[model samples]
Every structure is written in C-alpha cells, then in structure tokens.
Target chain A: AQTVTQSQPEMSVQEAETVTLSCTYDTSESDYYLFWYKQPPSRQMILVIRQEAYKQQNATENRFSVNFQKAAKSFSLKISDSQLGDAAMYFCAYKIPGNQFYFGTGTSLTVIP
Target chain B: DAGVTQSPTHLIKTRGQQVTLRCSPKSGHDTVSWYQQALGQGPQFIFQYYEEEERQRGNFPDRFSGHQFPNYSSELNVNALLLGDSALYLCASSLLEGRNSPLHFGNGTRLTVT
Candidate 1:
C-alpha cells in the first residue's frame, strides 16, 4: 500500500511572497507519479503540478514548482509570487501504474494581503 | 470545456437509507472515478469505472457500488448509509490511457447522513 503525508496542516504567506508546502510518500513501486492539487472555496480540485518519478528534473508550472527528491521520498510544492487567489487547501497525491490514487491529508494555504 | 459536473450538490439521508450521486464526465473523457472526502481529510478513492465496468476499487466495502453509462457518465450508490458515511463525494474524469493522464474533478456533492 502507498501513502502520502503532508506534515503541515496550515500555512500562510504574504502577498507576492513565496511559500513552500512539504509532502512525503511511501511506495514500493519504482515507477510512479506525484501530483499536487488545489481545492478552493468552490470545492473543485485543480491540478497544480505533477512529477514523474523517472524524471530526475523536477516539474514546474508557471508559479508552481516542485522539489522532488526521489531517494528521500519527498515532493514539495513551491508557490512563487503568491496572490490572494492562491489561498486554498492543497493536497499531495501519489499514483502508481494502477489506477489507485493516494492523497495526503492536505494543507490549508492562506495568502495574506 | 465544462470540466466535470455532479448533480445534487448537497444531499441528506438517514441511517439505513440509500443514496445515489450522479457525475457527468468532462467532454471527450471516457473514464470516471469516485472518491469520498471526509471533513478535514483528503479524498479517498472509492472506485473507478471504465467501459461501463468497475475496473478498480479501494478498501471500501460492498455497500458502496457504482455504474458507468455508455456516455461516460457515472453514478455512485451507497446502501445502508451510516453517519460515518457523511462526507463530500467527488467525481473525477480522465482518459483511460495510463497514469500520465490527470484527473479532472467536479465540485463534489456534500452528503450528510443524520
């Protein structure tokens, strides 16, 4: 079985500043995928960024990027130039070759003005 | 595109009662998966439907079942609902290709079992 862990329950960042959310996972599969998802007040879960375990280079999407350390089993999300709209609950997920998707407890992000 | 859409954004049921939640997949999507998100917890996979058959499931019991239509729409059915079953039910759509495909989610239906 695979599991994802988000140590931080809540985080806050000043507008225009940068913030990093930490996540870790345990999996036996050598080939897998990692993902970061955001859920706003509207309740829609949106994909933020994704990383392939085989890729040594981390994944970046506009302001959102990840620091993936495969050996350490760590995948963190960094939000640069944070805005008020970035305030939401962020979830870290893991998926293997199978369709089962495992998710962390989630971290609530607050962007302060 | 209209992403994924779920019907009855909110629902209330009692113990021993049954509930059915509907989900319409995003345009061009052929696979649908269902998840249960309890308050303050991440969503947990319930099952995945492809080609109108249950291709995968999680640790949930037989009480939880699902059906996928030819149009790629899906329904999650829970029987003998318990108070513990109260949570937000999410429907996600994606291509059946492989893990490379990301899931597009719908604003979940908040289920309350009283």
Candidate 2:
C-alpha cells in the first residue's frame, strides 16, 4: 500500500515571503507520480504541481516548486513569494500507474497580509 | 473547454436513505474518478470508471456503487447511507492514455447525512 504523509498540520507565511511544506511517502513501486493539490474555501480542488518519480528534475509551476528526493522518498512543496490567494488546504498525493491516488491529511496554509 | 462538472452542488439526506450523484467528465477525457473528502482532510479515492466499467476501487463498502455511461459520464450511488458518509464528494476526469495525465476536478458535491 502507498501512503503519503504531510507532517505540517498548519502553516503561515507573510505575504511576499516563502514557505515550504514537508511531505514523505512509502511505496514499493519504482515508477509513480507525486502531486500537490490546493483546495480553497470555495471547495474546488486544484492541481498545484506534479512530479514524476522517474524524472530526476523537480517540478515547478510559477511560484510553486517541489523538492523531490526519490531516494529518501521526500517530496516537499516550496512556495516562493506567497500571496494571499495561496491560502488554502494543500494536500500531498501519490499515485502509481493506472491506480488510485493516495493522499495525506493535508496542511492548511494561511498567508498573512 | 469545460472542466469536470458535478450536479447538485449540495445535498442533505437522512441516515439510511439513498442518494445518487452525477458527474460529467471534461472534454476529451475518457476516465472518471470519485473521491470523498471529509472536513479538514484530504480527498480519499473511492473508485474509478473507464470504458463504461469500474476499473479500480478503494477500501469502500459495497453500499457505494457507481456507473459510467458511454459518453464517459458517471453516477455514484450510495445506499443506506450512514452519518459517516457525510462529506464532500469530488469527481475528477483525465485521459486514460496519458500515463502522467493530471486529474481535472469538479467543484464537488457536499453531501450531508443527518
């Protein structure tokens, strides 16, 4: 079974600052995918970023980037220049090829203006 | 293009009652997946439908069942629902052929069992 773990329950960052959310996972599969999803108060789950296990290079989308250390099974999300709109519940997820996704408990992020 | 869309944005039902939720996949998407998100928690996969059949399921009870139509739309039906079933149900869609295709999610249907 694959399990994703997000250690941070809640995080806060000042506007224009940076914050990193830690995530680790346990999986037997060699090839899989990792993802970060953000859910705002509106209740829509939006894809923040994704990383492929085989790719050594990390994935970054705008201000959102991931530090994917495959050997250590660590995938942490880094938000640079955080904005107020970034305030949401961020979830770490793992998925194998052609399988369902395993998600962590989620970390609530509050961007203080 | 329209993203994944779910019907009845919010629903309230009594315990032991039955409820059905509908989902329309995004354009060019061939797969539909259902997930349950409890309060202050991440989404948990319930099942996935492809080719009008169930391809994968998670650790959910038989009381939860689903169907997919030829057009790739799907329906999730919960029978004899329990209070624990009160949560947000999210529908996501993606292309089956793309190994790394990311899921496009709907706004989700908030189901409350009283």
Which prediction has the highest DockQ against the true structure?
A: 2
Candidate 1 C-alpha lDDT tens digits along A1-113: 79999999999999999999999999888999999999999999999999999999999999999999999999999999999999999999999865678999999999999
Tell me the native contact fraction for each prediction.
Answer: 0.84, 0.86
lDDT of 1 by residue, B3-114 (tens): 8999999999999999999999999999999999999999999999999999999989999999999999999999999999999999999988866788899999999999
lDDT of 2 at B61: 99
Worst 10 residues of 2 chain B by lDDT: B95-104
Score each candidate by Cα lDDT.
Answer: 0.95, 0.95
- In model 2, the runs with Cα more than 4 Å from the true position are none
List interface RMSDs for the candidates, in order: 1.0, 0.8
DockQ of 2: 0.86
- Model 1's i-RMS, to one decimal, reads 1.0
lDDT of 2 at A30: 96
Kindly provide the TM-score of model 1 when superposed on the true structure, using C-alpha atoms.
0.98
Return the lDDT, model 2, position A102.
Answer: 88
Point out the worst 10-residue segment of candidate 1 chain B by lDDT. Answer: B94-103
In DockQ, how does model 1 score against the reference complex?
A: 0.84
